[model samples]
Every structure is written in structure tokens, then in C-alpha cells.
Target: MVPHVLGSGPTAPPMSTPVDRARRGKEARKRLPRSEHARWLPSVDRADPVGVLERQGRDRLPELLPIRYGRMAASPFAFLRGAAAVLAADLATSPHSGLTVQLCGDAHLLNFGLYASPERTLLFDLNDFDETFPGPFEWDVKRLAASVAVAARENSHSENDVRRSALAATTAYRTQMRRLAGMGELAVWYERIDAERLLPFARTARGRRQVESTLARARRRTSLQALGKLTEVVDGRRRIIHDPPLLEPAGAADAASLRKIFSDYRSTLSEERRLLLDRYRFVDAARKVVGVGSVGTRCFIVLLTGRDANDPLFLQIKEARKSVLEEHLPSGPYVHPGRRVVVGQRLMQAAGDIFLGWMTGPQGRAYYWRQLRDMKGSAEVAAMGPRQLRRYAELCGTALARAHARSGDRIAVAAYLGGADTFDRAVTDFALAYADQTATDHAALCAAVAAGVLRAAPDV
Candidate 1:
């Protein structure tokens, strides 16, 4: 069971002192000194990056594993995003603070973005949770820090800029977490990083305009828009048009099987949600390839039409596997892997997709369902200059801290971080060092593909 460092009750002790929570956090420094974070010591028995990649592809479709490998070959940042298992192994061998939170096990820069809440407001938060599980809170921060460094390096930023961006992230996390640590529980729970709050962080007119343009584009990405673009009238009925490899028709037998699974999925929803869901009639399902790491997994797009031919609802049912951190950290007390993803997502985000639920498919494969695309906007880290990247880094750090604060003892963590740059510099040092390791790993993956150990379909 996950233990709460802060005791619970109507008259809980004040967080400032509260039986020296801060003192304990400060004491943790002695056990795992901040300076030690600068090191990335891999043991002799560490898993080979290529071997791990091959093992992950075992259960995935053979045809699509090439695409997964190809995406990772694109760049070191892409490889880092896809190789969560590889990094998790390394991080598990590193020093930790023994503080645990629901982690976004793959908390790369691209994964922190804007998505619409149930109320239709776009909120910025961690958008990926496929690898989320209980582990050292530092793991998430480390991933984010390393991602920022790698991305800055990929964009050809100066070494100083890269260090600044990395430090900005950890410093923002430290500053924001300390702020949240002093707030009332409800206040912290209600806080969110919406579009309006993010504008001030834009350092230039171009950055501000980019934010506006991205928001406008996200707001336009509704179900109706997707329906118009992805469907066509065939046999006097609406059907999802095929875009081979990426989007294609599910086989007749598979579609029938999924229809039954929809009923089981409905049972997992609340009564109100079930009534709302019943308004739509299932029409068709399609296989959809998504994300760099998730390419080979079984992901499907289910179409449902409501009210009239113009009204549409698209639900993505993505396969869930054991978290990347499962081997590194203690396993969570969840029977269904899909449920684990759903619950971890809910805990880490201030709000989530309203249709979120999970079901077990044939052979007991776990899958979770949510809206296909609801005003989702991801930062083009490729285009970001040093200034824009630094601001983005700070925002992502603050966002991650808020997410961790929700699930872990904010007081203890904040106190541990304190008001110093020691931990910030240490994480930055580690991020840069790991960025080098990622480059080496990416080169190895490219070499593996070239040597025919793995096939790569870069265009796909």
C-alpha cells in the first residue's frame, strides 16, 4: 500500500512544522546527497538498449515493429521518448530520495501538452501515462530534465542554453512545489495550468502568437471536424475511410468482438455516463497507429454516430501493457493493466477525458478507451529557440510538480527541495550527462537497423 507521509484527519497538523516533515526531507539529503544526482552509473549487468527494444516488440504486431524502431531512429530525442524501459533500468540503479508519487514514467518534453478537460477548457498537463506507476518522484523530473536537454541539443542550441533550460525546469519544479506545499488541500487540487495562465510565460511576440495559433488549431479539432476529414459515405452509410498502415478497416470478426467489448466497457462507466454513451450507436472500427513508442500496439478507433449523421463520437481503445517501471519499482496493486493506466492518469492530471474507462479483450489483453482527439495541442519543440524552450521547460516543470503534489506529500517534498539551487544544478548536470548517453543509445539503435538486427520503416 502507498503510505501518506502526512497523517489524515479533520484536524491534521499544519504542514509547516507538522512533526518535522521538512526536517525529515532535509535529512534525506544526507542519505542521497544532491551532488550524487550528477552521476549516471550503469552496472555491468545493465540491459542492452537494443535487446530491450527487441523484447518490447515480442508481443506487438510483427509488421509494425519496424515502424516503432524507425521512429526511434529519427533523432536522439525521439529515441529517448521511445526508450523509457532503457532509461528506467538505468535510473533504478541510481540514487533516489525514497519519495514516491504516481509518475509519468515517460515524462518527455513532447508528452507535456495541452488537452481539453471535460468542461471543454484546454488545460496543460502531462498528456501521456502509458508508463505511469508508483516510483521515485525524481524519476519523472529526471526524464523531463533530460528531455529538455536533448531537445535543446537537437535544435543546435548553445551548451549554456541547454544547461539553462535544464536548470530552469528543476528550479521551477522546486519553486512551484514549495508554493503548493503551503496551500490548503482543496486549493492545490483546484489549481491548473490553463492557456490564460501560460501566456505570461511567453517571452516574445512570436511565442505568444504561436500559443494563440496552437490554441485555435486545437479548438478546431472537434469530433465534427474529424468526422468530415476521416469518413465517407459508402453503401448509403457513413464509414471510416481507409488510410492504409496508419488507419485501416478492422476485420469483420475483430469488429464483432470489439462490439461485445463495448458493452463490457459501458459497464465500467457510471450510470450518467452510460446514459450519455447510449445516445450513440456504434458504426465502425478502424486500426490506428499512434505515438512513437506505441506504434506496434493494438490501438483502434471506434466510430459512434449520435442524434444525426452530422453528429459523431470517436473513441480510441489503446492496448495497455505492464508499465515500463514495473521491473524497476514495486508493482502497483492493480489487477488490470488498463485500470492501472486509467487510475494513474486520473491521479496525475487535474482533469481527464470524461469517457475514460477500461476493459479486458480476448486473451485478457487490457485496453483503455477515451476520446480520440479533444482539443489536444503539443509543443513543436523542434521549432523552439532557447528563450521559448526555457519558458516551456519552466511550465512543464511547474506542471509536473503540481501533478506530483496531488499524489505525494507536497510538504515533505517541498521541504526536501528547500529554497536552494543545489538540487536544481544537480538535476541539470544529470540531464546533460544522460543526454549524452541517449545519443550513444540512439546511435546503437541506428547501427542495429543498419546491421539487419532490426528493420526500420522511417517513412511509415
Candidate 2:
């Protein structure tokens, strides 16, 4: 089935002026009432969550499948983090404003983090885009809001805290969108959330310390630091260590073909980036397991050195599969899955990785490559207090708004959201309700593992 691209072909704008566009957007709310968002009950024949996961596992490494299940089985929040496909199926049937944008697809709270820009400054934005695709703007927002409630529950916060944090997120999104809509097109495109702009959001002394500490830690995670920790001198040559199941040496054939893959990947970059990358020479590669959702997928870390032995670079080549949203939404015009991820990320991120590139593997599988660790850090959501969580939620909303404004019609979205609490309240209600569903689904996952229907390797 061919997926139709959102906002495709030449179509007249709803209005000429920004104010008129916003007004038209507000008018759209009549057909798709904000209250429609309050409906969160799954349909009688909704797709089974476990079945979707098991089907996805077919395309991944057999040995690491148990680890993926174990991670999700840890908590409801963990399950939500890895189950973008499950939520995509369910959200496809939900009410939308008919407005579309490049979605984060899995815009949970943990996905927002601090990463370095080319200037070495810490910029806060959405860090994961494995499931990124063109979809209704609300889907990303809903997923983010629902995650707040789920995380709140996991942290043992009161019901009021959950509702408050969720509401704060939507409110911040709406407010920021309205502000961005008032700016010029180029101005909106250039807007970003860096550390300097993020200081006001830290509400307490502890929060301030957390921010400073996270930034300090991110700046220190350079390739040199990774080289020292992940590799060792063996017989006078630096080699990656083998820690079975987590980090194992690639097969002889896979290692031999990596040089060609690296060459093909370099060709995808711009002339300047390619020139910059030419200084480094590929050394060795190892099969490595990564994030919870990406555990079973084929991930390899390639070690490279430049000029001398002290100068090192680490590039992570991760398998890119069809987006979870593809079945439910229009797929972009990209033949290779790696291109889809690369293009989608360029469209969404304020500043992207310099080494970002894509190539097809020996088996014709698509993969994208980027620096393995470049000042990236995520907040400790599990350890956050209620106040910190609410503040973090606000920051996430702001970051998401900036991303959508760059890809979608900001004026129209602002109009659709308007200067009211109706949509905010409805989203809060939906998040709370969905958090309940997540708990129930998590229990079912535990049951599946206990009944021997699924295997799980916990604490890995």
C-alpha cells in the first residue's frame, strides 16, 4: 500500500496573512472539537501490543530479543518508550486537527536531551528519531503528554502531580507556538533552545545544579574519553574490548565489508563534510547493543584514528528499519530506510551531527552513521521530584514546538490551539487515561514472560 504524503501537491493556503491563517486554524477546531481528545478507551478489536512487538522482533537479532522484552517489562514507562508501533496503531484512530508535520514519532519525555552543536555549545532538543515520519502534529504531543503521566505514576507521584505536569506541557506548547507564529518565517526557522535560554526553566537550586552537572558531564564525553574506556592496547595496537552479548567483535566477513560501507557513506555527506571526514581512517568495528528499543537491531561501532594514535573518532552505524508510523501515516518519498531517518532528522533537529550519513549494508539493509558520543545526555527522569518533572515537561513542550514550527505551518497551529485551556485540559485527561492503559499492558507483558510465552533477560 502506498502511503500518501501529508500536505502534498500544490494547495492554496487557508489564508494569505498570518493572522488570517491562524484564524482559519482556529475555525478548524469546530469540526475536530478539543473534547474529542478526551476519548482514550481502546477499541474492542484494537491491535494486541505484544503481538506487534513480537512481529517487529522478527527483523532483529535473535539473541538480543530477550533483552528488549526485559527492558520493556521493567516498568510501564519503559514499555511506552519501546512501543512506538503500538501507540502509532492506537493513535491513528484518534481525533486530529487535520494538520500534519514531521513527527518525532516516539516523543516520550526521556527522548528530549542535551547534545552539542557544531560550536561545542549545549543545545537541548529531541535526541531520538528512529520512528520519525510525517504525521499529525497531535500524535507527537499526545505521546509526550501520556509519557509524563506514566512516568509520574512510576515515580509514585500523586494524581494531582501527573495532571499538573501534563497540563503544563500542553500549555507551554500552545504558548510557544503562538509566540513563534508571530515571528517572521526565517526567524521561526532559526529559533532553538540552548542552555542559555533554558536557565529560567530551572525552578529550584537543586534543579539548577542538575542542569549544570548534566552539561558538565555532556561536554566531557568526547571521542577520546570513549576510546580510553571502550578500547585497550593489545600487543601494541588499540582494539575494542569484547563483552559478549553487549559488545562482540564483528564476523570476519562483516569487518572486511565495512571499509566499502564507510566509503559509500562518506559520499552521502556534503563536499565540506566529506573533506572534513577524509582526515580519519577506519580501523576496527564491533557489533554493539544499544538502547532498549534498539537492542535487537544490528548496531556497530566503528573505530577510526586521525593523524596520530592519540586522535580518535567513533562512529555508530545503526540499522534503520521502516518507521513504526509508516503503516498508519503517509511515508515520505525515500526508497531507503536510512535516507528516511537521515532526511527526517535533518528536518526536525535544530543542529544535526556533522558526521551524519547513510548507506546500505551487505544484506541490502539500510543504516545511518553518526558520531557515537557527542556531548549527549538525558535527564534522570526516574530520580526527578514532582517540581522538577513539571519544569522538564515545560522544557519538552517548548522544544517540540520549536521543532514543529520549523516543519509545519506555525501560524495555523497557533490558531488551532488559541488562547484557551480547552485543548490542554482535554490532553491532560487523555494522558491520565492512557497511563492507566499502559499499567494494564505492562501487567500483561509480565504475565507473558511468567507463562513462558515470551523470554526476558532482566538486569542486563
Candidate 3:
């Protein structure tokens, strides 16, 4: 089925005035008070967290299931990273503000990171879009806030500090949304967080040094760097090096399948990108493991060359399944899951990879393709102190608000938030309560593994 482009159908209503939009937002408060966001008790019949995970894994590679479980079992923070489905179910049990946007679906703290924009400038924004879908704006906010709380607690921060970090994230989000709400549509559309702009927010010589180091490291993470690290001269020709289970050569059949789908994927790109892609010659591919939640999916990295071997381009093909949100919210526009991801990323991200595209692969599996690494880097959340974590949380919150403003009704959301810290405090309470729930769920997973109900391989 052809997906309907938003704001284009004949039935679409005329654009509402800012006053009307603000009034609508206030009306929603009558249905669901901003303070109600703090509520987070699991229902009596809430689904088993492990069972929810198992169901998600049924269609994934069986051999890789153990890695997924093992990674999640490592800690409560790790469990939260891999348990988007669990959180989706829990969030569905609570009422929302109905302020919809293209959610990152799994907007954990780690998911916000640094990447190169199309103009080659470094920027910070929501980088992961594997589970992108339309849903209540607060779902993404809550997930991000909860992730901050979990990470802060894992770092042994005081409970007061943990809540403070979570509150920092929510407050940044609210204030940024309100700021964007006042701007013209074009201004909001052009908004972006340049990596250079983040340095001043570090607040100390040490923190500023760390930020500089991260930006430098991200700058060095191009495909050429990946080529040196992930490939080697074999028989006088470069080929991907094998690292069993994590990075292994794709079998002959799998290699051929990727090549066959290459043209189909290219067709999805714009004419200029298609011409740009034609400059590269396919070299080699490998079956790769990625992210905590994405571990078991079919993933591959294809090496290509432009002018010569020295000019390398690496593209990743990752399987795209129905979003975890799909089961809880109303159906979205796109029938093809891969298209859903690509479109969502374009809609929400200020600048996106030029290589982003999608296609159906072998056995009707849907997959999206993009540059494997283009000066990409993520913050080292594990090493952050309380002050640093709170600052980082604020940055992530600001980025999330910019993203939400692009796709959702910013005026309404901003009006609902107002100048009060009620929504911020409410969400912080939810984050702490949900962090406790995540700990309980993590324990359940470990118990299942111990009982042989689930197998967990050692962390790779």
C-alpha cells in the first residue's frame, strides 16, 4: 500500500493558528493532568518481561539470541537499553498527552550522539532510528529520562543526584520546546545542534578537554579509519578480516544476496545520491553484530571503493522489523518497515546521511542501508560523574526537543509544559520509579538464565 504523506491529503485541515494550538494543548490537561505523568505502577496482568523479549526474538537468528540476553543481563542500565518492547508495554498502561511525533522509539541516553551532517560539519542529534515510529511525544521523553536515572544510579550517584539528572533532561526538553514554539516553521526546520556549540556548555577545563577529545575521536572515525581497522591486505587485495560471531565473512550465498539487493537499494535514493553511489565498486561484506537490542537481527557491512582502494566507503545493511511501538499505538503510514525507518529519520534529523535508503532483501526481509560510520561517536556515559551526567542529560534533552518540534505540534506541547516545572518533576518521578522496575526486570532475566529457561552467552 502507498503510504500517505503527512500534511498532503485532500482531507487535511487548514493550519491552525498558534492561539488555537495552544488552547488545544490546555484542553488535553483536562483529560490527563501534567502531574499524572509520574504514575508508573505495573498492571496486575502486565506481560512477563522475558516472555516479551522471547517473542521479539522468535523471528531473529536463534544463534544470536544468547548474546542479546547476555548483554541485557549485565546490568539494569543495559537491560533498559535492550528492553524497548518492555517499556512500550508499560507506557501503554498509562495515559499520555496525545502530543504525537516521530519517536526514536528507543531514545535511551546512549542513543543520542555525534555524527557528521551532509555538509561535513559535526552535529549532535538523535542518531539511532531502528525503532522509529509515530507516537506520543512523552514516550520518548520518559524513556530518555529513565535511561538517565538508570545510568546515574549505576554510577553510584545518590538518589537525589539521580533524580536531579533526570529532572535536568526534562527541563531542557521543556524549555527548548517552548523556545522552538516561538520560532517560524522554517527556523524550526533548520535548527541543529552543532558539536562546536556543545563545548561551551562543559563548564570546566576538564570537561571541555573531554569534549574536545571526543570531537577529535569522532572526526577520525571515517570509512578510511574503519577500512584500516576492519579490513586487511589479503592476497594483495583488501578483504574484511574475520572475527567470529562479531565480525565474520558473509557466506558466498549471503554475499551474492547483498549484491543482488544493491541495485534495489540504490533505486530508493535520489538521483544525485544514485550517481554518487555509482562511483563506488563493491569490494567485500561481512555479517556483523551491532547494538544491545539489535544484536540478533540480520546485519551486514559492505565495503566499497571510490577513486581507489584508499577512498573507501562502508555501508551497513540492517534488518528492520515492526517497531515495538506498533503493537501499542495505532498503525502508522508506511507499510514497509524499512521505508518507515528511513522516512522517520529524514523527518526528525536536522541533517541525515546522504546514503540513507532502504529495500526488500532475501526472503522478503526488509532492510535499510546507510553509511556504516561517518565520523560517528557517542558519549562515554559510564565514566561520567554526577555533574557531568546532569550536563550531558540536559544536552540530550535539548536535542530530543528539537527533534520532536520538527514532527509534532510544538505550540501545543510547549503550552502544555508552560513555565512551571510540574511536567519536569512528574517525569523525573516516573524515571526513578521505572528505573526500580528495570532493576526488578533485570533480576528476573538473570533468574531465567540461571534456571536454564534462557541461555546467555558471555559478553563479547
lDDT of 1 by residue, 1-460 (tens): 2222212211222455634867777787776777777887667897899999999999998998998999999999999989999988888777688766778899989998888998989999999999888777788999999999999999999999999999999999999999998898899889898877778877679778888888888888888999988889998989999998899989998799899999989988889999999999999999999999998999999999899888899999999999988866655768688998998898889998889999999888999999998988888899999998999999999999999988887777887887888889999999999999999999999999999999999978
User: Per-residue alpha-carbon lDDT of model 2 for 1-460, expressed as tens digits?
Assistant: 2222355311234548876787768876876877777789898888888998899999898999999999999999999998888888888876577777788889999999988998887899999989888777888989999999999888999999989999989889889998998898778777888876666768778778878888888888889999988998889988999898899988888898888788899999999999989999888899999988888999999999999889999999999999998887654667788988898788788999999999999889999999999988888999988888898999999999998888887788888987888888998899999999888888888899999999999988
Which numbered prediction scores highest in TM-score against the true structure?
A: 3
**Candidate 1 vs 3: which has more TM-score:** 3
lDDT scores of the candidates, listed in order: 0.88, 0.86, 0.92
| Sliding window of 10 residues with minimal summed lDDT for model 1 | 1-10
Tell me which of candidates 1 and 2 scores higher on TM-score.
Answer: 2
Write one digit per residue (lDDT tens) for candidate 3, span 198-268.
89878999999999999999999999999999999988999999998999999999999999999999999
lDDT of 3: 0.92
The regions of model 3 sitting more than 4 angstroms off are: 1-14
The pairs that clash in candidate 2 are: none
Native-vs-model 2 lDDT? 0.86
TM-score of each: 0.96, 0.96, 0.97
lDDT (Cα, 0-100) at 380 in candidate 3: 96
Which clashing pairs does model 3 show? none
Residue-pair clashes, model 3: 0
